[model samples]
Target: MPRPVYLVDFSVYKPPDEMKMNYNQAYTLSRQWKECVDDNHEFISKVFQRSGISPTESYLPPWVNPATCKEPKYDMDSAKKEAEMVMGGAVADLLEKTGTRPDEIDILVTNCSIYCPTPSLCSLLVNKFKFRPETQTYHLGGMGCGNGVMALSLLRDLLQARPNVKALFVPAEIVTYCFYPGLQKDYMVANAIFRMGGAAILLSNQARYYSTAKYELLHNVRAHTGQDDGAYTCMGWGPDKKGVNGVYLRKDVPVQAAKALEVCLRRLAPSIITWGQYAEAARNLFERRVLGWQVPEYIPDFTKCIDHFALHAGGYAVLKGLMAAMRLPTEKMLPSFATLRDYGNTSCSTTWYVLGYMETCQGIGRGETVMQIGMGGGMKAGINVWRALREVKNVHPAWRHVAHAPVTEADLPRPINDPEAAAAAVPAGDIAAAVKASFGADFKATTAVAAH
Candidate 1:
């Protein structure tokens, strides 16, 4: 049998307070950029308000903050600095808390969808922290948000191949350069939701660290629907009609994501499901294939085996799509919703934020399993299965603001991710009332400064 891999610990970067951009600030920044193109204040304001993001949700890069600048600075230098702050801070925190030296890491894996600079982030960190020359460095760029668990998959394989070694994985997205300065509504969604965040995680295969490890890696699977043209073209980074660059999120994204989830789950089910579920699936397969029952494929009850879920916080619809398809309850979906409400969509780092919420707020008992599911622009889905070695309730700085009062279902925006809400024009007042009901006093206080 192959040696086991363990997650030593992980750190989520909490941006400095000055970088926190409330809803109104984000709207102001978006309006400033749209003024040159298609500035319809009322329409744009409605979009921001109804985006399923609350008043206190996202953090902006220093250059993109309305409080710090008149307009966002989207140049290469600013992008690099943004990377340094989020990624550098996360890595530093991991090293400091774990007491692990830079040179001690046998492998370094970094991922950033945009803003991959020359010499690469891996080399930049190696030089900055002085990792040994022989350290194995891998950088994944433009792979989209699923790269967080994808990195975990990569690290798992590497640890299985090489024993007695440590690896540092950093997943982040630099929203600075990705800021859309154009007028296209499809492209502007990126500006409204994508936020600044990153995470540094340490993994080890050494038996000596097993006792201190949080979880033991069980299985990692990744699947893509890129074979389908719709999936492949669902999301892209390119220039619009006006020749202005941005990430275009297509309407078909939710559909394609559901398909990708189906593909990933099909591959992952056999490994994680119970023998009873396996028997049921086998019977379903026989009926569908041999008997021609025209029945739907079996979806095993994941809650039966998996104790916790750290799902992707890509968007309200994305989470809902996954929830509906998988038949999960609102209680199991709280972590992802809370992450989206607190940090917006942090892209590749979203799953880490979700996991951090569970660690800080919902304790994971020993021997319990955690399944992290993530999907991103590639129309890809990644799943990581881990079995906790010890009970974990450690507080994380990323969740500090809400850790004291755990996020309940009442805290999330309602009338969200529903077809009726999507089809009809939801009165702005109704949406505001829903938000007010959800947040209560906190919503009133936050909206005092955020409301236009």
Candidate 2:
């Protein structure tokens, strides 16, 4: 028999007011960037105005101050300090919530997309908390914001193979080193968002944990669109003209992400949707393929399958695209939007904040299903289906101080449709040429396979 994985408890890091950044404070900090002149500042302000992020969202690293506005120190010591601040808080809270000691964790997994030190995040936790030397530890890096669900999927598999063990998963992105002060518009956009946050989650297959567990891991589906040249470079860390390293997000990222999500949902729907919905989708596929009939695309009513959504709080455009593609109602999209508004894009940990919002505001009931979706730099989309095991009455510390303001579309910034909004110097033709040149014969065959 397979070991059933359950989420015993989870905690999200809440940065102090000292690190909070309002719209004016963000603009002030942007002025310190290398290429942020009056015009660039104005453009960035406009972008933030439409970014769906609230003015009161928190940014990170106690070192980031508008009054100082100095370039963040990206040394290893600073990185360690930032990790301690966020990860320590999250782990402490999670341990308290689960009533588990550090030594009780049989497996420890830590994910930080950009910062992986010699000791590794897992090792750091072990040293700080004094876990047993035999405890299993794994560190995941460069997997992007979707890594939280990816980590959960890995934990589920681990518990299945080794039953009756407790695991701790910490997902965070340290913004100190990732702060880009470059002239590249794409890279500078990251500076506008990408705040500091982290989440610590505890899972187990032990029978004792089941009664207190909040959710059960049901299914996880992942789709990687990196095979396509367009998806590969849509969002990634690269150097600018002046050799300043930073992450860049293409304007067409939402379009590329939608394509990837469509593929993932196609694979995921059959497992979660009702039998009737599955039959309809199967018929639609048969008609389009075997029957050679031009049939309309079949969209499963996901609301019937899942009661709550923990979509990634990536950005305004990304969330908008996902809401439209999945046919999610405004209320269903509120948690994601509200998370983005309050925390900005907390990278891998953003989905946890969304889940927290759902518990705090929407009130998920026992046995209700939730679909947690996330996308990241690998042009990867991940979905995790979870069923609530028990009704949670305790509010997470992160949501304790947050006001219960209802989210509305009006809270988000106005949408923009300028041609420049989608403009990029790296044309499609150039991307194709580069891919062909780099991969030679493999590029053509891979492109064909991806298209099929």
Candidate 3:
């Protein structure tokens, strides 16, 4: 099938629970562990040794307070409970925001990596949202940080197949649930970095949404590395106290994964570079004397080519790596850095918030391109390109600027996604359980297998 033009519409929910930290307040605190502990044994230093994030006696910011390195303070039960509630709340809010009822949504894609509840689809959302019978739903698990794009890609494909069908793509990953007590460098990075985030995007292939200037998903590209165990590997979650599963993140993630991007991009988009460029590249490869020598020649004029860049807002180093790999200027990567420094990494939904921020405040120009990139465990990377068709307007409750914003850390919210752990916990042995209880098993398991 020719690439389908999929219109992207999104809803981001940073629950009230996540607003516990002051803006960059938590990161600021976590950044001071060197003084809080011995420089050689500081938490940041251990996890990011390669980055030279050693303890220093240098000045630190006021809000950059160290996380009480004590056992994770969150109650697994409570987090799941909250996720259960927030999951539905987010969907409801999405329905209300988009002015669409549950049954109206023809295709549903829900992702909450940390928690997959019993009667997964119907239990988590369908029943609560009052959906109609036979709503196609998919639950994505273990797709890690890059799964959001996977979900969107699936939705786009489905929408293209059934042109009038409306697809609701929701990425709800809550980090608070599985956080365990331990200063292990890798785990500490997960704790210090990942937080709560839930986003519900309404997607369609309808000509109307496109004519109105929504982000149209033009293409999707996926890259995987570390599969052979050199630098890339599968990332998983383990059951902790009370059976809450906390995820494992590799420390060698950033640099190791960077090398793999070239291979993945080429495989996914054999034509990402046109024949003319390919010929030039081929000449450079075979005949050193033939290719262009100008340094700026290979670096596309990102500013002129793309109107805005909503990078994953993954982290400082990751964003920097993307800039280098893409050979983009610093200005292009600012939105991502700003988002990470302020909100920390919201995992799956981070890139969407960046897009939303651009959509609301900065305003996307007509026919401009907005590049969205996401990367995470299993050392995955997802890049889905967007094109704006009209004037993008302001949408409130957006990601606030760290320097100029009035929204405080109080705005950061903890979003949850466990339906089984409600006041009445669903039994674990409910397998052979009805599809409702096994909501995400099919898709999540399948995605994991596909990645491997």
Candidate 4:
């Protein structure tokens, strides 16, 4: 049998308040896009009004500051700066929480979908934290939002292969290079939704840390439908007709996502659900196949097996579709919706934010199971099953502004264009100070680097 792996601790990065992008600021910046016509303006306005992204939720890279540069200064240097700001802040917090040093980590895995620079992010972390030269490192790129759980799946295998070791996993995305300067509605969708965020996680299989660990890795399952041409082309990053680069979102994305998820759930069901549920499902299948009954296909009661559900906060439409398909109640989806409302779509780190919301706001009890589901580009889907080993109720910095209660429909306010009204709605907090303290001088230096 494989050695058991436990989650030592995790930290979610909170962007500084100065980086906050309200609806008015985002729209104002949109107007600066070269060749943006009246139709483009109408589409952007409609998406902002209905995309379920709140006014005070998203943050942009300092390079896109309207006050300084009219056109975005997207290049290798800007991308590197963003990687440092989000990843550095989260890793600093994780080290503080786990009380672990850089050299102690036996393995390091970092994932960023679009920005794969020379001196990979893994190398960047190694240099910043002074990790040992012998540290084993892996970097994943172009895998999209599903990479959060996908990285966990990779970590679990690495831990099982090498016993008595600790692993660090950081999943993030740099939106600096993904800004679309073109007029294609499909390509411009990324500009409207993608935001800046990330998370750092520590995992260990050593027996010494098991007692203090919050959860144990139960199951890791992944599915990919890239073999189908439709799925392969649903989402991609490339230059448009004008030779402008961006990540395009085809209208077929939702349909492809559903197909990818269906393929993943088929493999995940047998591992988590009980025998009784399986027997009932088989009986229903028999009726539909051999008994000539008009019964529908069986979908086992996942709630019976899982206590917490951390679905990727892709967008409002994605969340609603998944909730309806899984037959989950509004309460089960609050964490994901709340994350989307507060942070927009942070790509690979979105599910971690959802899980943080659950741990900080709605405490997960000991022995409860958390099923994290991730779906993203490349038409990929992944699931990570975790069983809580301790009651986790501590307040996380990522959700510092949110009240420690279940988020409801009323909690998600509509997007507003008035800067003063939006700022007033945001609760006064020391989040900016907290983030600054985490990176200290490093944050300042990175911001300065991005400003040029």
C-alpha lDDT score of every prediction, in listed order: 0.77, 0.74, 0.53, 0.77
CA RMSD, predictions in order? 6.7, 7.0, 13.1, 10.0
Question: Which runs of model 3 end up more than 4 angstroms from their true locations?
Answer: 1-3, 23-76, 231-235, 239-245, 267-286, 289-304, 400-452
For model 3, residues 1-452, the per-residue Cα lDDT tens digits are 55346554566665553244442344455444443334323544333222111122111111222333322335545555556654665667777866787878888888776666666743567776767678888888767766776566677668767866678877866665545444333333554455466677787766666675376776677766646684455456664444544554543344444544444444544334556666665555554445535432232333544567777654444443455445465456555544554445666777776766666556677777776766656666667778776666656354543324532223322111223212112232111121112223222211211111
Query: How do the residues 1-452 of candidate 1 rate in per-residue lDDT, one tens digit apiece?
Result: 88898999999999988788777666556556534454544544545455456676578887877667786789999998998889999999999999999989999999998778999999889888899999999999888888898778778889989989999999999989888777776666676667889999999999987788999989888887788898898787889999998887665565566567667787888888899998998999999999999986676777897888888876665555456556566788898888887887788888899999999998899999999987776778788999999989989998887878998877776433444333123222222223223322222112211110
Q: Model 2: per-residue lDDT, tens digit, 408-442?
A: 55665432121222212222222222222222222
Q: Would you estimate the TM-scores of all the predictions?
A: 0.88, 0.87, 0.72, 0.89
Looking at model 2, residue 406 earns an lDDT score of 52
> Model 2, which residues run further than 4 Å from truth?
29-36, 67-71, 282-293, 403-452
1-452: candidate 4 lDDT, tens digit per residue: 88999998899999888888777766676577575677877776665555567886678887764433577778889989999999999999999888898989999999998999889999999999999988999999999888898778789889989989999999999988776768777676676677889999999999987679999999888888899998898778888888888887665566676677777788888888988998998899899999989976787778888899998876655565566567666788788888888888888899899999988888999999999988777788889999999888878888977745656777775321222122222222222222122222222111110000
Question: Predictions ranked by lDDT, top down?
Answer: 4, 1, 2, 3
- TM-score for predicted model 4 compared with the true structure: 0.89
Better candidate number, 1 or 3, judged by lDDT:
1
